[model samples]
Target: MGRTSDAKEKILSAAQSLIELRGYSALGVAEICKAAGVPKGSFYYFFESKEALALAVIDEHWAGQKQDWTGILNSDAQPLDRLRQLFEVTEAGQRAGQQSCGTVSGCLFGNLTLEMSNQTEAIRTRLQEIFDAQVEMVDSVITEALARDEVAVTDTREAARSVVAQLEGQVLFAKLYNNTHRLSPLWANCLALLGARVPQEALAGS
Candidate 1:
């Protein structure tokens, strides 16, 4: 049972990497199985279909994201500083060649929201819930910062949404341009939007 679980995790990780490099439409079950070193029989045993596997991949991605974000939020550092570190993790991922986020790989949820929302209500609803949860997490962090007087945002919810939007936009831009340069301005904008003590000149230059 443990070995079977490990195989399933390996397949999900491979699928995630492949989907990030090539959008979902370009990936195939055979490729995922090959990358994972699992047979097609095992793949079928674990996932009923490619769509099911995709959903699993999404769940795995969000699980990892939640863990990382929770750690950031619970850290002893100042809230705003913790947020900056979040961006730093993003930049580090890009630098480390994880150039795209699984959730934003062609903006998975966004793409599905447009293409499959009508056909696959379950997937669409799940995707929406995941994104909403992400936004709520950010809002909770920002709200705490406001309560502590560590930041001065006019609206914590809107500020959190803006941060999410900026990050999503950066991912889209990076994917479109095939370069991380498009993300530089977004980091600056996020800091400004959060009312962080970013230098005016630096923000302007970014």
Candidate 2:
């Protein structure tokens, strides 16, 4: 039982790394198994297909990300400040990934959305749900900021979607350019999208 479970985890870890470096379409089950140090049969035992494995990887990645986002977005800090921290955390995370891997890995969900969303209905639907959840989280933070008059946005939900889109787009740029610095504009851009009432310079010092 222990070894069986360990094999499954090894496969997931290996698949995520390979997918980040290359992508889903370029990989094969045998190659994934080889990287995982597991037998090809073990891949079948755990996941019925490569797509199934991909979904598992997406779920696992999002589970960790959701926790990090909840910590920052749901923090006791001022609402807009929480949003700023979220951007800061994103930049830091991308920088860390570049240092570790010599390139930006970008957001997994975003990457898969571009690479696989149209290729499979199951993958498309799952990606949509994940992104929708992200928008909802951002919407909650924006709504709080709206209540405090920290931002001038009348449509918090739409503003939140734009903010999330901006973040994802910046991350895509970071990955495409293989430079983490490309993510530096996220906070400023997010504030602009929200019609933040605070001066950008003042917010920076706060």
Candidate 3:
């Protein structure tokens, strides 16, 4: 049982890497099996189909992101500091040329929504739920920041949504251009919107 579980995990990991690196539509189950060192028959033992594997990958990705974001938001640091840390984390990943992670992988949910939402109600609903949960997380963080007086904002929910939207836009632009450079202006704009001054050293091109 343990060996079987390990093999299943290996296959899932390989599938995720391929999806992130090459986009979902471009990934093939055979290639994933090869990368995972698993036989084609073994994949069926774990997942019913490639589509099921994709859904599982999406769930795993969301779970990991939720944990990371929750940890950052719940830290003892000031609210603004927490938010800044989140951005810095992403920026560091960008600097490292990590274009394959979920957020910067051009939003798996959004991609699925665009491509398969109309054809598959299950996929569409699942993606919507994921997005809704993300928004709620953002709202929680913003509300906490407001409570702590770490950031001054008139509307926490709106502010949270705005931040999420800006980040999404940055991801889209980064993916479209195949470079993180396009995100700089959006980051600066976000700082301006928040009425906060970005550290000069952290400014793009600085």
Q: Which is the leading candidate under TM-score?
A: 2
lDDT scores of the candidates, listed in order: 0.75, 0.90, 0.73
lDDT of 2 by residue, 1-206 (tens): 34999999999999999999999999999999999898898899999999999999999999999999999999999988898899899999989888988999999899999999999999999999998998999999999988888888889889989999989988999988998888777787888788898676744223
Instruction: Quote the lDDT for 136 in model 2.
Output: 95
Better of 2 and 3 by lDDT: 2
User: What would the per-residue lDDT of candidate 1 be over residues 91-194, giving only the tens digit for each residue?
Assistant: 56665563344333445556556556676667787888988887887898788888887667888888999898888777677656757666667656766777
After TM-score superposition, the amount by which residue 73's alpha carbon in candidate 1 deviates from its true location, in angstroms, is 2.0
**Where is model 3 more than 4 Å wrong at Cα?**
97-104, 148-155, 185-188, 194-206
TM-scores for candidates 1 onward, in order: 0.81, 0.95, 0.78
RMSD of each: 3.6, 2.3, 4.0
Question: Per lDDT, what order, best first?
Answer: 2, 1, 3
Worst 10 residues of 2 by lDDT: 197-206
- Give the TM-score (vs. native) of candidate 3: 0.78
**Deviation of model 3 at 46, angstroms:** 0.8
Q: Write the per-residue lDDT of candidate 3 for residues 79-195, one digit (tens) a residue.
A: 666777777666566656453453445655666666677876667788888878877876777777667654567887777778877777787787776676666565455555454
| Residue 139 miss distance in model 3 (angstroms) | 1.0
